[model samples]
Target: MTDIPEELALATLACRAGQYQTSELEQSEALFLSSSFCFESAAQAAARFSGDEEGNVYSRFTNPTVRGFEQRLAAMEGGERAIGTSSGMSAILSLVMATLVSGDEIVASRSVFGTTVNLFKNVLSKFGIVTTLVDMTNLDAWERAMTSRTRMLFLETPSNPLTDVADLQALADLAHQHGAQLVVDNCFCTPVLQRPLEFGADVVVHSATKYLDGQGRCLGGALVGSSALMEERLVPFLRSAGPTMSPFNAWVFLKGLETLQIRMERHSRSATVVARWLDEHPAVRRVYYPGLESHPQYALARAQQSDFGGIVSFDVADRAAAWRIVDNLRLFSITANLGDAKSIVTHPATTTHGRLSAEDRESMNVGEGLLRLSVGLEDPNDLLCDIEQAIG
Candidate 1:
């Protein structure tokens, strides 16, 4: 019912992100489900295609619903524009494909998702594109890894599964000094808790299928950046390559955006409770959560993020022991996905980051006993009791 507007706070923008109430108008944002709209005349259609007029021509590159989602997400992210993709991986692919030529390099974090690691080593390697993965916490590694060929610095802060905090300001500064763009995956905190661009990241990416969708119902990803880069470079690649986010899924994301703030808050509160409890558990070896007072980067996280994210990673004594706890949990889900309303859990070494070699996993401290928990909006006491029962 409410009109989506540019002049809004992050919380308000979430509720308003993609729905425009136009005409005599309905209260809720309308889903324009038609694949194509008939133009008033042949000349009008030509004008629309030629960019002389502003309206939807096809659901592929241009659609009201998808555009609405893009606008809303972009607004919420504090980005100039956003382009939604079919998946988070697709968004990364589109970004690299569009911006880099044959010789450009990427300085990425080693603690990224396993599929992303594969994309860099396997897929991008074939094209003469070089990616150097560095310790996310070690600024020295990032600086030493950079070369004149480097065009992008890509990382996921409070990185996947481990919740390793990369100093965003430091990474951004280093990248910019070397004439590189900083691409941050804002999937973990979403805009509800953190805005990477505000901390000097040049571009922000998201697995909207996660927190942005909030319900785990659809697959989607997004790239948010300056309008110049998003429209001129990314949009052209998306138009040709066709990894475009579907209109129906975009509508779903739009719906998800409305409650993003509240859900993230609850997720954070619940996660902190779990992380704190785990730190005291006899089976737990180490807990990695920015929210914890004992975390190495706790101060930095507090300075930047409004709240700690839902993800909490911990280590048990051994692989068998970790599996014992994970296998015993009844309420938590054993899935790779995070940022859902229902709590999810996974053993990173054998699941999310399983593809990495032993050395790679070891360097990042992702062990057989490493477990990542994505806390949801469940009762904290119930979740904690479930953990106690599982580990006992």
Candidate 2:
């Protein structure tokens, strides 16, 4: 086991953060593929299960590979501990289930992922957990919606498709005043860019299935927070519910982390180039990249994130035109998933946000003409050419 030096740079941490080295002294982190660990005696097994001793007991809630990924991510996010989950949605589910009871309420941003909205509005509602949706950037709206029962505040900054940036510090302050925990989904801008915990947020969530994997290879998610919360709350929920991350996925994420910083930096550069081109193009009605000077929260994005992330969204003439562009694109993958090496183009109105009611979609401004692009590590000129031909 290794402890990363406090002064190491993020680039260094990405590659060196996790505790590694087995009896064989392997340079890379070993994947513990076994489903359960064998102990020397029944006493030792009881000790492991009862928390009287520290060692792997079962892969469902304890695995060295998964623990390594959690430790590395926690180190990167500046949190005391991190718990890995099966997927991004499961991370949010585990958080809610672990901390909030049926009578509690949640204040969430309307600009979050559509699946998150479903989880809150449809799924959690069945359990008597009420939720209030508010504009991510409107502090007054957040304050107005708070109630005595509010237990959690959730949002995704530089929100999905639109790149709507939220004031993390302000929201965190507001949540604290109401005795609610502020949970920030840092999926778009990994710890390499924005760290919500640094801005007073109580918890940071990540869809490790996205940029954390760098490639679209594995599914994983994480929640990072104080050790007390992870040990006392999240661990129990995971132990009982069994929404734990697989050791194989954890190993994949570990490999992805080794190159995360470099990938994000390149993704940012290419995305900026493509976004500027789109902003000037005649076919584009509007661009939603925080890197652009035209973005309303450009200053805040610059102040908070290391760079504008890889996603670039814009409006077209209509849904017909948007679909035509998606159909014509030769280089981009027409998938809902983003944060990949290959560019992805999606019509949020018909794809990601399709499940929501029309009124809800309208409220989120996910119009028929909207097109979201998960910019990749491709040549900007080639992507521009694809757009040029597709737009025509």
Candidate 3:
């Protein structure tokens, strides 16, 4: 294992961190495909299994390729350690299960991904964990939601589909005041734009399935935090539960990290262009993007993030109009997934947030007309032309 300097820029760290070389000295990171590692002797095997030694025992908890990805992401996010998971939802599950017991509670932003709402409301509720959803930007709402049992404050800034930005510092301060940990999902911004840990977040979670994988080629997730939280809490749960990322996916994500920063910058630029175009269009009743001056949290976004992110959402008149636009698009794929090399357009009311009750959807302001666009690396002009033709 070669140590990457702390002083190296994020782009350099992305490329060089957590690199391990074999006896062959290959420049690229090697893939260890074996399920379990071999030990030199019975004593060594016993030691490894008993944690008296630090080496791979099983791929479920210890694999070189996955460890490398974890190390690299931890360094990028300024976290002491990271734990990899099979998918984004699994990461959140592992974090909640590891940190909170029955009778504990979470205060979360209403603007999170639809599945996250279901996870907290439907799944965790069955385990005796309570969740309260509040407006992302309303500090008063967040403060009022906390209680003696509130163990965590969870939110996604520039939130899913809506693009509503939260004040990280304020939320962190509030959580700490109540002796609770602040957990921020960094899926949309990645480390290239906003690092939640730097703003006093105790934990930063990533759907590495999103921008971290860059090309949408793999399903993965990670939790980045202090060594104590990761090793003491999350690791045991992961080892027991076996929601483990495969070595192949980890290798794919490693390559993705090398180009992540550059791709995010391009995505931000293109998204900004599309957002501006939508803001001026008569067909678009409203646009949701932190980069736009019209955005409620534009100033806060400018202060906290290096750039506005790649997602841009807008509303027309109704679901029918939104569907017409989506159906006519030549370039954008109509999919629920986001953060791909190819542009994606989703009607959130019918797809991402469809499962929520109408009242719940209304609270999140995910209207029937809402169209969420995951702007890609395509030429901004080409995307604009596509939108124009679709609208026509």
Candidate 4:
């Protein structure tokens, strides 16, 4: 692979970080679509399988295209290494399976994706791993939740559905004081907007299906951390469990990374406009966007992130009004997924967080009236017009 200078700007690194040309010297990245690589000799095969030599033996654990994606994303995140996985959820699962024992505990934010909440509370509980949920914004709650058995502290900054920003540095400090790793879900704010590792987080995870793909084209996820943690713990679990990212998807993500910085900037700019529009609208009771001065964590967001990100959420009168607005929208796709070139709108209480108990949803602030919008690259004026007609 080509060696990218660490001192280079992020945009330069994104475009040029992980290219390893073959004899063809292709201008664009070449896709290695084969399931396995050919070895020069039987001894070479043995050496590869035995980890004595560095070469691609199988697609499941090692592929040139996948390696390129991992390397580029790692560079962008400023991490020592990165590992790609099948999907966002699989990345989180791999991290947990690799690092924690059955008796270990997790301290997680209640403001995470609903599926993540289910994974921690329902699935992991069956294996004797307990997770304690807390408010993402409350330092006191996070500090109080830590225990001797706590192995991980997990959260999403600019949290899902609500756009709640957490203080990453404070949480990282608190986690380390308790001998725990702070694992941030950098899904909402891709590394283009916010690099959590820079703020003392031990590991940064991504739902590359979102902004990384940028067009809602593929499903992928990744973990970025010290090379020791990735190679020693995460890679083994990925190899054994077979939650591997496809080489084709990795190639697609590589292309996505090239445009990520520019796309994120556009997303942020348009989202700010949409957020402001919603904030002032008579129908919107509350607008949750860190870019707004009215947001509780606006100052922290300005300090920690390059931009406030693309997701904008707001509250209306009730579920009826929320559904009415959703049904009325002609331009925005009503889907649970976010981070796309095309705008998307979702009612959290009925869609993303529907599985959670009503009490749980209420506690997390995912109320029946809340509507989450993933403001896309569409003209801000057009988006506002679409929203205006819908709200009416």
What overall lDDT goes with each candidate model?
A: 0.90, 0.94, 0.94, 0.93
lDDT by residue for model 4 (127-163), tens: 9999999999989999898889999999999999888
- Order of candidates by lDDT, top first? 3, 2, 4, 1
Candidate 1 Cα outliers beyond 4 Å, as residue runs: 1-7, 22-24
Each candidate's number of clashing pairs is: 2, 0, 0, 0
lDDT per residue, candidate 2, 321-344, as tens digits?
999999999999998799999999
Better of 1 and 4 by TM-score: 4
Q: CA lDDT of 311 in candidate 2?
A: 95
TM-score of 3: 0.99
Candidate 1 structure quality by residue, lDDT tens digits, 1-392: 24454577888887766666769687667777877888999999999999999887877777788888998888888889999999999999999999999889999998898889889988998999999989889999999999999999999988887888889999999999999999999999999899999999999999998999988899999999999999999988998899999888988999899999999989999999999999998778899999999999899999989999899999998889989988999889998798889999899999888888899889778999889998988899999999999999
Worst 10 residues of 1 by lDDT: 1-10
Q: Which ranges in model 2 have alpha carbons more than 4 Å from their true place?
A: none
Candidate 2 lDDT for residue 295: 95
Stretches of candidate 4 exceeding 4 Å from the true structure: none
Check candidate 3 and list the clashing pairs.
none
On residues 90-144, what C-alpha lDDT tens digit does candidate 3 reach at each position? 9999999999999999999999999999999999999999999999899999999
Instruction: Provide the lowest-lDDT 10-residue window in model 3.
Output: 1-10
